[model samples]
Target: MCTFHGQPCTYLRGPLPRKRRKATDPPEYRSQPNGSGSGSVPGMTHLNLNYPHGLNMTIPLDHHDEVEYPSPELLEALSPSLAGSENLGPAHRQPSLLDGTLGLHLKTHSEYVGLTNYREPCLLDLHPPEDPHTRSVRRLDDFTIFMIHRDRETTSETQRIADLDAIEKVVHPLGASLVNLYFRIVHPSFPILHKKVFLEKYARSYHEFSPPLLAAVYLLALDWSIFDRTLSTSSWQPDQSRLEALALRTMNDDMKRPKISTLQAGLLIQQRAKNNTWTFTSQLIALSHGLGLHVDCSDWAIPEWEKGLRRRLAWALFMQDKWGALVHGKPCLIRPDEDWDVRPCRIEDFPENAADEEHDPEGSAEVVIGRELFLRHIELSLILSDVLRTFYTAKATRRNGTLEQIGTIGVAELAKPIVLMLRDWYAALPEALQLQGTRMKKLSANGSLHLSYTAIDLALHRALLRNVSAVAPPELRHAIRMGARTRLVSAMTIISNLQPEHTQSFWGFMASAQLASIGTFAGLLWATSDDDLEATFYCERVEEYLWSLRVRSQAVPFARDALRMLEAEVGGLGPVRASNLPMEMMRI
Candidate 1:
């Protein structure tokens, strides 16, 4: 009974009353550790009584049967919370529970909590905040601060300080001669760079110009400079490898912040670097897109010169992508439908130098010689792009069916329109750009124009070669074989007439590879032809062409190897057919 609630209360000075036990109960429950008799109270049962150190007891009761108590040993196993918790008295001791549980609440907020939940260390701030007064006080004055800021702005500029003294020392007084050589030799095939603007910029500090462009100009000029006694007899000739490395390094550095000058530099590097043209051209395409060069700028409020530059640069990239596809056997990157509305370039786009009467607006020389070849080249490239889309693209091939379908009848059907377009393109070429006999140099732009035309024709007809043996209707097979033979003969004749010395004048890698491919194709044609007279004629002509290649440039080892292989196959003048030739010999 409770006394505070005014209920009856019973007070006991000793332990609580125990339950009464029957006679059959265990003796251990009746006897206490002090040897005194204490019976179990009602509603309680003594389950066990064991004494090892002090006292250990187990009681079973009717009311609370599920109560649990841990051993004292487990209670003492906790880690220390404070430095001297182990030495603390029982009343003062506190348990140190494991982290990330109720024990976390026991620890101080600052001790357990962190700025972030992750276990990784915090990152150090590289650009920490500074006081405005500190920043202002560090400067000497307003003029000095302005100068520092100006220098910082200039650091982002693409133009770097070129060693003009070294350049002047190398070219000496023959600077004009080198410039002339570049325009005369390299500009015709690669008209992307404007000669008039280049000279105007060059008149200023050479340090202000892009290093890669200047290096490319110097390297290309060095080739023709060999023919000039003024530069050739100089104390020092420019090192080709060094200049190339410099141009490549500068191009790579400027690639991150690409500009129109950077694109021009890349094109120049592609022309000189033989193996990296495809890779560089692909990257250049991406860079062009980043600058919005793919979009038409006619409506933009830019200078007329800038608009012309954009058009030229855009077309140049288009041509690069197209020709790169043909040369590398890769897909074209620039799609006609997706490209911008940049119009065809005009003659006025190319600035005229006061001293050059040929560039006069009223002069016929400008039409005949200046920009005519470039415009024609662009037009032909457009046609080539159409041909690639119509026949070679993956979507077109899928639409036509499998490779077998394309090889059997699809190619012949597609070749009709492309061949007609090629014919029209050739007919429209200016008479000045036509490849005339001994009157023109073999490696002139005229020669390149004709070679491009022939190459496209060959590419179109080569698809039919595989169909010649397809199990198709007799009339269809005959037509395919006849068509292939005509194109092959025409390609062979065109290649045969090319003076090997003139090929050295060409700048692009594609032309050289195409020539080798033509030679290889002719060998396959000669081997496969049923007509002995025609086969012999082609065989003799190809052999002559291969010999010319072997002597003209050591760069084309493919030609040398192909010549040997072909000579081996036809050495005995034995009867050979396409099936007898190894598959390797038939590949371009």
Candidate 2:
């Protein structure tokens, strides 16, 4: 059978033809939330403006062909809280500590771009099924043409490759150690690059790897250099700015002939907020579609290893899409009812069945829970993903403006499923993934995962508060209030537990500072929203987190800037300035 990406071409009933719309046909226009190509922020114009690549955004399949996930009932029955609040360590019992709060100065906005306005969306690049035009013949670009031959690159691509020759010197004597650091620390959380193939390829020659991928590896590793004994003591300190600039340039070049490596570089570099923007993320999602990573490949004619890799990368992209949309306050690119088709990741999909472990050459420490963190993080993303569709969507929020209009039982009923999902996620955590009394660790392998859970939980509880008050049903309001306090406490506990390992891990560059700021806000809101001694209790934890933020200020970018904003907002939050909270949330 004739196929594309090993699936039958459903429209190939006859030879290809080109036909235009007749005047009497139905209008084929619809609103594309955030997936359109345009310039609001990053340099999105030059990337996807005219790229003509086909994407199988939707498939007609039998009812039984759909994927499945655990039900809320099953999730709620999974396990109790791994770190039960009442039993939390001395931090919970001791008198509140107050050193003060910490702040960020990164300029993501250009003079031309406003931080609030979205680009004017025109039309979706996707082919509408009801379009009045007939399908045309397929076309290939030079990058794809050369990739099919297996032995060469296009001339322009070769020129692009030559531009990154300086990377060889950038790694110099520490290249191997940096790669090891990546596989050890960053890879476990991100896990985009496969261990065996990457190492095998590197053995052949540095050139065996794409400049973007190679450069991204060493660049991310540099963030964790202090943890590596060999490189930590060596006098060689590479210019991170030069490395960042090189990775960014090569990554943009890699996009010309978009491949798996292109997506890899994009995901890696974007881990740091300093290196990413909403525009850049949209470009990555577009490239992922161009490469056909969105479609299911379970039965494709590919190696078993490749199938697994594709699934992992697709889910990783999904996490990026959902989280990026939340953080960027942009429309979500992946619609659950539309373009998202990949199934939830399976255990077999990871490169290693047994979690990978790394013993530093110093023989100082070993960590193998990277897989646990990666898997659980995906689950957490799925948790927040539902919030995006259910309650936070523009349409959903607009509808929510009415107070429990009619048919629905209001916010409580609507929140039940998400509450159950979060419960099950926490309950199901393997022991290796659980935290105790917020114990600080030197590595904190699973720390980021739990910390992220607090961030997501805080978001949920905060949203619930708008619909709740003393007038709301007593039990319902109490539950939400108690839950919000719990999440704030959870966040405070984890924030103070911050370690170098956690800060330098995957997404460390941005997540550490951002989560800390979210926790501090949760505490402030708790302290002011209700009058009780409990406010002081929460404030003490906030102070502890602020102290941690101060200690890690140099290690984590934007830590102090985020704190300064919090202090300013707190200062201005007289009854007249409470409006600033939403702005701060959006900025964070």
Candidate 3:
């Protein structure tokens, strides 16, 4: 009966014969709106003769015990297909009489596969979510495409249920692809090669989307993956040649690109300064301990030089931290308290809401504070600290009879001059910056409070070295000078941390100001050459200071390293011409 073998079919249709009419309900009879025993609506009257004819003609007087209807066993003889039709598949074959009936072939497939049987729209019910992860991924993907294809289009949230269902299925599959997309393609540089590699290798076969479409999809996926670890520095083991090449490339880039404008550079410096305060202080302490050159305030006179250097380092760190906070849009913690003594004044008394500037000219001076100063200060501190460490170590040699005894008198003598320089420097500052009253009161309580430590250190060193006159034989003066030089080199290591913005400035200071100062002191020593004086005086200073600081445990080895370096430098000095040497040196 069914010619089209595999044609579509509906499962629930049939053409079975109609049931016979009963006495009370004849086949042609109908109940009207008013149920007046007539086949008609409320306003119409019509007779039901045809319907009653079937009921009246029903001569089913087969009351012969109902013919003892077929037993259950006899009814089982019928085909099983008709009996079990309800259990058939949606498109299962129907009885011959039901052929071609509408909906008989309708099929219900598993929802696991999304397409509907008719290829028409169908409702998909998903669970309510606490967080819209699926929704975000789907939206981001579409947004990316929208942004790329129609740059001017607005990202509205209006969407269809089918799109929502599709989003849930795609999120997990697209995670990594999206992350790589943002880092490589959407990144500011959009390096062509990185993009190509990202598309072909990283994101290829990702959801079978077009390459351009994939790029945007990936970016959206990546946004949710950000964490703090993304910004940290991991261990980097680089090949030597590769490292060298990169360095060279960087140098080339520097040469080709115009230098950062002053304003830009200043902003950057200020930013660095704000953050560097805490970082630098913590780092310096760690580095000092690691290098075996820590200072202990209890046992020995904290050399004025060390004191000044630390102050500089601390201040620089503070300024850097302040700058960082500014860049982060945070309230500055470095600002002074608001309560200050001023003549009684009222804004209302001024004309047109403008202040009377005649009384406040000094407050209007614009000052540009930048990281350059902090960087310089840090460099100087590091340089000086290294110098002091070496000096401390050399003086601490056991043969020198406990560096404390030998260096105490000298440290004390230099303290006065160092303090004097600090006082002068403080006095030179603008009166506005100079604190008065209780602030000065606080300074007396805390000796490390001011920026005058440099002076304190210079005076301390001068006196400490002078003590050598009483402690060491006159012949040892050259050795003491050598010890001082060794420490100077160690302290200069901060130069390594100087950023490009401050590099030239630092190097210039090194070659001119710093070197000049060291040279002047070196000339005062009896050692015949730079090498001799450094080996003896500078290294010795490091030893003595370390012993006094009680960090002598580590200082001894560092002192020895400096001594060795000094020896090598002096050893390489080819024979000096007799005429070119200091004239009186030959007589010695």
Candidate 4:
């Protein structure tokens, strides 16, 4: 078996045959005939122009297998001169004897040309004899040759070895503390890398992993370490800038041959970026495509572990593209039409260790803890992508006309189905993953899940507010206002309940911006309500939420900024109602 273009091929046994073509063969087998000439061969129904020499040949359409034949017009365009030539010869003829004049002239004139025993002077050294004791070199078979070349092309960084001494100096001292931080925080949200395989390789040798990925793991691990009381107090501090620099340098070096590690490193860098997170995420998507992460690997003859990793990474990137679009207010990169049929990830895909089995029943513990969270995240992301495609997309706006037009027709017509979908998603959540009655942790996967759920509701409610007005049937306008108000209250409640210490646990930058939008939207609702009692009630809840955010500013500074913005907007509010407010003010 051999691989071609990343797909497998098989060899079939055949015997070599000896045959010679005559110059007198039919015109169809020879060079193409000029215009109006009879070039058709007997028993042939179709003719194709063979490449390079404009040779016309009989290649019946029914007999053409696998390959797509070019059109006659295209063939003519490629070789107009040859096809139009009047004086044509048999295409299978060998080169003429008179082709090389210099060789013939030298042989005819030289005195020593016919003297076979005469030796010629030489400048280069004679070929060396092969060693008798050593194994003789044999010609490689076709499959072996292909395999060698493929390996050469795909292998990442064969020339340079990472500095083991330097890497060990950084990672070894942290011991299991770094690993704990990753599993507890990073892995729960972005489960791109396999923990068991990573730890197993790290234990064998720090050099076993790619330098960029190793450095990335340490960098992200250290970010979470600041939250760990014991680890934070240690006299020795990890150099985050140094690790990040090393990771970035190594990542650039390996750009020509991107591996799974390269994708993982890109994701880690994206998490840490303050300004260009979306730009970096887009670069990661391109790198992933280069690594064939966008192509479904289910049929590829790779290991089960690798297949699982590919599926996980592909989905992770898909989520990044979709969610990043929402966070940055940019168009999503991964369209449903362009994405491959990569399957949803499974629990068996993750590498297991003895520690994994200790949590619950032998067969299902991993599913209960990590896999469910990841699968649920994937499901929610898919819904979010659809939401963006439907309501938020430019195409949707052109079709639905302005927000007032959409509201005139009833925003609930578009929003009702999505609200049901969101409810169903929440309903289907596993008991362990549910937010209700669950004690929120500083970095709980369940808490992140709750935040995501609330974010979607906030996005939908904000969309409805785009055209909520008295002109749009009274009932529809009232429903839109009430829905927006209720969702705003719910979002504020979730944000207010989050403890100050847990602020860092939320996904960075994007989550902060999303929380800020929620607060701003709540302020808009409170400012626009006509009823004094209702306005006052929402005002107090908004103030309470702002107070909570103010106390948590040390952990979430963006939230603090959001609170200040909301206070300024609320302070300027008068009798001006939500229906009368500018559409821009109501926008999320």
- The TM-scores of all predictions, comma-separated, are 0.64, 0.67, 0.20, 0.66
Off by over 4 Å in 3: 1-236, 239-241, 261-423, 426-524, 528-565, 570-581, 584-588
Model 1 C-alpha lDDT versus the unseen true structure: 0.54
Candidate models: Cα lDDT each: 0.54, 0.56, 0.27, 0.56
lDDT score for residue 269 of model 3 = 23
lDDT tens digits by residue: candidate 2, 1-588: 444378654552322222322434432211111121111111111112222112111111111122133333433454243124333233232111000000000000001111132521111112322422211112121111001111123225365446545886776767777877777667766778766556533543465566778888889888778767878999888778888888888777666656677788888888876676889989999887756677665544333456667778888888888778776667788776777668777766775533234223432122346666777878888888887776667765554354334222477777788888888889988776775412233355566677667767766765676555335776776677787776666666665675655554455434644564575555556443444455555556556656666776776665665566556543222222233345433322
Give the worst 10-residue stretch by lDDT in candidate 3: 138-147
Say which candidate scores most in TM-score. 2
lDDT of 2 at 245: 84
| Residue-level error in angstroms, candidate 2, position 30 | 47
Measured with C-alpha atoms, the lDDT of residue 377 in candidate 4 is 77
Candidate 2: list runs displaced more than 4 Å: 1-157, 353-368, 399-409, 436-442, 469-471, 499-504, 508-510, 513-517, 523-544, 555-565, 568-588
State the displacement of the C-alpha of residue 575, model 4, in Å, after optimal TM-score superposition.
6.9
lDDT per residue, candidate 4, 223-342, as tens digits? Answer: 666655546778887776767777777767655455567777777766663533777788888777545566555544333456677788889788778878987888888886666557
Worst 10 residues of 1 by lDDT: 102-111
